[model samples]
Target chain A: MQGTQQPTPQPTAYPATDRTVPTRSADRASYDKEIVHAILDEACVCHLGFVRDGAPVVLPTLFGRVGERLYVHGSTGSRPLRMTGQADPGLPVCLTVTHVDALILARSGFHHSMNYRSVVVHGTAYDVTDPQEKFLALDALVDQVVAGRSKDSRPANKKELAATAVIRLDLDAVSAKIRTGGVNDEPEDLDLPHWAGVVPLRKGYETPVADPLLAPGTELPDYLRAL
Target chain B: MQGTQQPTPQPTAYPATDRTVPTRSADRASYDKEIVHAILDEACVCHLGFVRDGAPVVLPTLFGRVGERLYVHGSTGSRPLRMTGQADPGLPVCLTVTHVDALILARSGFHHSMNYRSVVVHGTAYDVTDPQEKFLALDALVDQVVAGRSKDSRPANKKELAATAVIRLDLDAVSAKIRTGGVNDEPEDLDLPHWAGVVPLRKGYETPVADPLLAPGTELPDYLRAL
Candidate 1:
């Protein structure tokens, strides 16, 4: 079986383009789809950037991922959403998500760094037009917040769906950059009396505060309980 | 004494420009200097955006705030840093920092949201040339990662400083948007049997992992211990 096995034909990484490649610290950049997807899924929000009137604008917003596509939703009246819908082809955008895992404190200030995982996606965002696809995107967005949440929450009604606008960006040009492990202090600075180490940052959910208007018989959902 | 009293002349908020205002959720946007500063100080990393080749590009990087100025440092050869240095005018940029406080899960998918504080600055970033300003910026960058860290670590030497490039963006044309409190569900869906509420997210630091080659007698600094 080992000698006769066929070479794998599938591509497991996103094709690296000129835009996705970093000019410095190229060793930290990765095109691995698994690494990219994990970083994207773990992040709660994505900083979306787009050009308006020849100037760059960046905003933080919630996003959901379905396979190789990302869905970002906002009010139909939102400027970015309106532009995505009105543009001839689509709106060029860059979406980035970062998770800081730890703070690397070194003996030298120049060596201070962060242990982080970040994914950047450069693509054209098209407004979601199809009703069925929009519904799926909405469900994915709800589930992205909490696993199994889409089923638990009431689906958006026709009026509600009409009020929301969703833009879809395919994950074509994507790259993940990651830095991990401990402090890297130079030999000369190792004995400088500085306490060098890795201070890990952790994200945790505290007890959920039930809404005052919640139904009397409703119980905390298992999905949230797990968190 | 009452008749002689003079109104305070100092401005407590930033001047909001057209670009700083959100097209939607205008009510969430703030021009208060204190609000913007607090949000910026709490965040460790910021998503910086610039137009490259006529398309928007967003990358997450470490940043520090000193009064009204924000500084971001990286390798001198990095793409954005180089562009800021070479551009005739300063490079136009949009810097955004966001902190998610809680997840709002509602009875309906449409009502789901997040409680977050975010600041966005629209301005041109210029490369820092003055050696004194660069040194201060570098110190602020290190301190931004951990309070009092700049003093604890050795300052960058001449060669190290030469290898780093710092870009400065003034906190003009800045706005902060904040959302807080509980789920905002429609009255008709309040009794829909869903456990709607806010799940608070907390950021914490785990025990510090000392470097393998840390000085034998070095102790954890009080600044880190306080964390």
Candidate 2:
């Protein structure tokens, strides 16, 4: 009976908007949905920007993506969450996540740069009010930390759920800017007797430190072992 | 004659203002100058937020810090850099850097969190015009990527300087927030059959990849070897 509904067709790219397009280095920007999702999913934290008192405020927080929507959660008393609930038109925000891949050392100071992949999303975030959607978002947030984490852990109770506030931002206006490969030094400076190359930076996970209070019978989960 | 001048006394902590204070998790926020500086120095990129057309925009950019000011440089045609030059009273901005040290998996989904250190600076940014200060800031920016890098590379020429725009923001309004240690699972859920611990994340520099056009005699610098 459930098979009668048609699955929504997914678009390959996000349409470029005035805000998503870069004023400089336009060649580095990509509106491809795959690139945007890959960059977002690889990072654990995002810097969220919102306007307060006619000034911009940027805060770093954990975020999770489900399909085309990104969810950020915090305590009910948090400033941005409370503002999102009170604002009728939703709170306008810009969320960005960046991963610095390599340090680009050029022959000249002017060309020194960092190779990075970053995604910036400009949209209005609305408070998630529906209980079903709220629970789903919460699960996605947990699983974002480690795959299959939501099912392995005990779910939130009524009181804990009431204390949290979740905000959802649709990924409509988004772009991924990437700087890869080696440094681009001027042709004249190529012969300069200075070291020019890329110092690659990689993120690795060390051994997990288990809590002292962990139950004796509890074993390390398979999902974490895979990580 | 310069020795007779009094040395500027450094304060141990940054002065907290209304905006730097968080509504929730007040205990996790700190105003110590040393803590703020350590977090900033360890980060390679910062998310710079500014208001444009009455909406918030956050962009990831490379930055450098001197004694009391932070410098961010970009092409003269970049959006924020151009706006800083044109704004009379300077552009109000928020710059934030974050380091995710570990991932905390709790026995319950409600307690999942990340161990992170983040610094948030809110101030007005002005364009740097003086040639001497501009050069100093540019040197600092290069050294921020690699210690002693500016001395190794060719200095920027007049034409290069003309095409670059540098913005200065004072480190006046700032706060650092940190979360460390193990997860805090509910007492009732402590016996749950789930693994709870912290997965430590470390950043490492791999073997330097040299450019094919590098001069034959050029060698990897000692500073990079130290990394």
Tens digit per residue, CA lDDT, model 1, A1-227: 66988988878999878888899888999999999989988866899999999999999999999999999999999878989874458999999999989999999999999999999999999999899999999998888888789999999999999999999999999999999988888888888999999999977789999999889989998898999
| lDDT tens readout by residue for model 2, B1-227 | 46988888888888878888888788899999989989998876899999999999999999999988999999999999989774477999999989999999999999999999999999999999999989999998998888799999999999999999999999999999999889999899989889999999977788899999999988888998998
lDDT string for model 1 (B162-187, tens) is 99999999998999999988998999
Q: Chain B, model 1, TM-score against the native?
A: 0.94
Candidate 1 residue A120 Cα shift, in angstroms, is: 0.1
Worst 10 residues of 1 chain B by lDDT: B79-88
> How many collisions per candidate?
0, 0
